[model samples]
Target chain A: MEAILKVEDINVYYGSIHAIKGVSFEVNEGEIVTLIGANGAGKSTTLNTISGLLHSKTGSVTFMGENLGKIPCHKIVSKGLALVPEGRRVFLQMTVQENLEMGAFTQGGKTLDDDLERVYEQFPRLKERMKQVAGTLSGGEQQMLAMGRALMSHPKLLMLDEPSMGLAPILVEQIFDIIQELHKAGTTILLVEQNAQAALSVADRGYVLETGKVVTTGTGHELLESPAIKKAYLGG
Target chain B: MEFLSYLISGVSLGSVYAIIALGYTMVYGIAKMLNFAHGDIIMVGGYISFCAMSYLGLPGWLATLLAMAVCTVLGIVIEGLAYKPLRSAPSLAVLITAIGVSYFLQNSALLIWKAAPKVYQPVVSGSLTLFGGQLSVPYASVLTMAACLVIMAALTLFISKSKMGKAMRACSEDKGAAQLMGINVNATISTTFAIGSALAAVAGVLLCTSYPTLQPTTGSMPGIKAFTAAVFGGIGSIPGAFLGGLLLGVIEAMAKAYISTNLANSIVFAVLIVVLLVKPAGLLGKYVPEKV
Candidate 1:
């Protein structure tokens, strides 16, 4: 598989505190890669760094073959990288349809109508409540809108942070199912989650990040059986 | 008949206020900064119009257009020089810088244009009585109302239907998410400021036609009044600001005629306070619950 995104020995700092320290990872085309970690493991920080929300102090973030180190967040997105940020940051003031339309803000060359249709097809509930304000949507609905919105950008690499963070167990199952559908539909994914067990279940490959460092990388099944993973994350 | 005339005057003046309020609301919406220099930009417009009409001896109509163009460019420059650099600064820092810019522009105008109020002599010196009552509607009033309505309509269409408008709305709603979607946040914000300031210039020109006297501090009353309109209509809602301005104008005018002119300002504020207490989000604003 060809690597779509490569983060090589990148370090990110928030003032004096080192948020992501010397982290390295790669996501191949058409693969779902999960980053699993406990709270404050710098999983989100790494994702943010990749999405250009935070600049790296050292090393490089190469998308395809081009260096994305100096690119602004909007330009990074135009290069086909989309981040569905944590806590479902939908435009609360806008309607569901408007939120989806905004997703195609970077579609400089493509027609948005096709993308809008695709998003509607993927999330029928959003289509039903297209005129309703995003903030009024339920938690699960908002998560779906967030994913649909990212999909509207036609991203080569889709990064999600804590998609199931505040979801009910049933909604979590549904969200994971949607993730599986998205993966099957040929969208490359980089997922960060605190739900290690569930994340490891669907991920083709997994990275265990502890305090901003990648501690382990393996096939999902392989990581699920590891004793360190079981004792700490998968409830023994 | 007397009350009707006040209503007419208020509507005309209110429309101008609404246009000016747009600049404030748009900048606040996208950048979350007040752009306190907004008022000074209006003052600059008045001065520019004064130059074109008085200095260059152009007609009022042509002078107003030129002033609008100048003020628009001024607004874009202010964004580039003052607001853009401080995009990531604390709100307090940005606000102080805005005030500083406003004061600087006003005082600079005093030095350049002189502190004395310029009497903007209108080309049309006569007023027509309409509706069988002694009503004074200057040709300038018609021009102002028409221009305000056109701009308002155009802006509404742009925001609701245009691609850049969608980007602007997105940026205002969620800057991070909008950026992630490839919206150039800076460009959208700058465009917002430009459009807003241009509208303010138009208001300033028309306002000067009605009053014909503009000083360094001419923007203060309208500035504060438009701010109240922005809040009254819902700060971020484009149409809401227009309605709020009209509401305020009518309220103040009616209060002055029925009650006392001295109490008009207080009455408007009292109404605003009541409206806010009843609906914290302003008349047209919706309450968006934050996720803790």
Candidate 2:
């Protein structure tokens, strides 16, 4: 009952293939929940369904106790859910500032600039390159820009899909630090990652996805300590 | 003095083509479809204004506005009915659909108005003398050029400064990413169609004013020319369309004056082929490598 987002027994299909089967999870308010999985384990698919980019074949996605069925992808964002997609699909031709402005497209008035300022403060690197075109930025900078752009919408529930997919080790640490800062600032997050180590380090709870199903779930620490997770994901 | 007159008329003609090309480029930008029917919308606009002023006795300003309104609705309707359903279809199918719509509009206009050329008086009749009559440019030519500039200026500001404009740009960059930001991709696309169609109407009305004749087939040649301009400038680029239109116009005028009128279109197409061979991305278009 206390969960801000509840995914109950959802099944998603891509064409004739079953992409996700009977998957369920809960994200409570003010908690960072991570979904750690190997490639082709349907990690991105699960997040895409929740973000309304992909439709579920069965079951329900309830956000704040409201069913998010048949809602268009854009409407889902206006409902205070933002997805920082994989590959950091920022508008490459636009300047950093313009990309941020697009995040607040649903808003009617003055708050857009204010929201942009808030985002800039959170990601100062974004502030420095506000006028730089997004494509010209490095891979890590583009990832930060993607996260910052999503934050500009003042989303109640933020979803990050593989935020550290291609960053250097140092940059990955910086990215995780920013994520921890966001969590501390009370932003509820649903994180999807193949980098189980960094994801579990900051996550309050974790779910292990394999073959399109949740095989195990626990506190971040418990998953880190588990022998199976250590052998498979943590490279122990 | 004679050279200045030719330059003025060429510019005036080029402005009309630019307006039409703007429609093609804009539709292609947001929807990624060629919108071949766009040129025909200009024909409809010309006929609408012709009917309103000639048949209904409305004033020219009111008639032109009516034409604009009708064309805007028609554009939206075509997008909603014809293009929206095929959003996910392959590019070839959509292209064929656009060509079909173009033919349908042309034939329907023929059935309603016949093929007879209707004489259209320039909105502001007669030529205006400039530089002590050393260059006598028609008022219609001056008006057409001014209108083109105003529209271009307004469009530039809108794309750069407005929220919806920003959304359109975002969609052009990546539709899925734009949707993640809460932009309704379908709605943005519809708005783009509306704007493009309105510009088509402007071009149609102005073209008729300069030439003072309207027929069901009037838009065909100009439509092809404008499309060539779009390709010449770079299909998805705004400034590219403008530059392409102006250059094509000047080239056409030069070919007619110095060479033969029969060779004008050939020269224009030859320039397109040469430019494309030299720079396939168009003059102002950036080479965007597809992200793997």
Best by DockQ: 2
Q: Give lDDT tens digits, candidate 1, residues A1-236.
A: 89999999999889999988899999999999999999999999998889888899999999999999989998887788889999989988789988988887777636778888888898899999999989789999999999999988788888999999989999999999999998998889999999988899999999999998999999989999999999988889
- lDDT at residue B188 of model 1 (Cα atoms): 88
**Candidate 1 chain B TM?**
0.95
TM-score of each: 0.95, 0.98
Give me the candidate number with maximum lDDT.
2
Q: Could you report the DockQ of all the candidates, in the order they appear?
A: 0.81, 0.91
Candidate 1 regions exceeding 4 Å error are B123-125
Clashes per candidate, residues 3 or more apart or on different chains: 0, 0
Candidate that scores best on TM-score: 2
Native interface contact recovery, model 2: 0.94
Q: What digit string (tens of lDDT, one per residue) describes model 1 on residues B136-204?
A: 676776776687789889999999879898888888878888888888888888799889888888888
